[model samples]
Target: MEVTPRRAGMVALLALLPVLAFGIFRTWWAGAITLINVLIIAVSLYLLMSPTEEEAHEAHADNGVENASDEAL
Candidate 1:
């Protein structure tokens, strides 16, 4: 079965919690570092895993708007 990027990201995020918890238990400094790293990973995952459908839809919508503008003129 193909795992969607979204599912992969969610799994990764869920897995991150235990590691973060460990860091927090060790020291606040470690937790803060872990959090920063986690944030970076999350952002990267978000950007990389964004659905292609949205990009296609936005491109289509832009053309649609242009067509509508032309029609109005």
Candidate 2:
């Protein structure tokens, strides 16, 4: 459920690819569409690749609970 620093870095790099491509090869409208496409792709990739909510909850439940309780204090 936890994202390693290396994996986070890789995802960040992948998300920036569209911007880089746009800067290198497109005009205004094309760049805008490409940027939107990139965001969709990044979100899709994250959703597809990330662990399920149950898994994340199980992995971080203790920390999550503590944080929630702290917020109410």
The TM-score, computed over Cα atoms with residue i paired to residue i, of candidate 2 is 0.48
TM-score of 1: 0.54
Top lDDT hit:
1
Candidate 1 lDDT trough over 10 residues, lowest sum:
60-69
In model 2, which residue pairs have backbone atoms overlapping below 3 Å? none
Clashes of each: 0, 0
What lDDT would each prediction earn against the true structure?
0.73, 0.69
Those runs of model 2 whose alpha carbons end farther than 4 Å from true positions after fitting are 1-25, 57-73
lDDT of 2 by residue, 9-72 (tens): 4676576676867857877677777777777766666666677889887787665355655788
Number of clashes found in candidate 1? 0
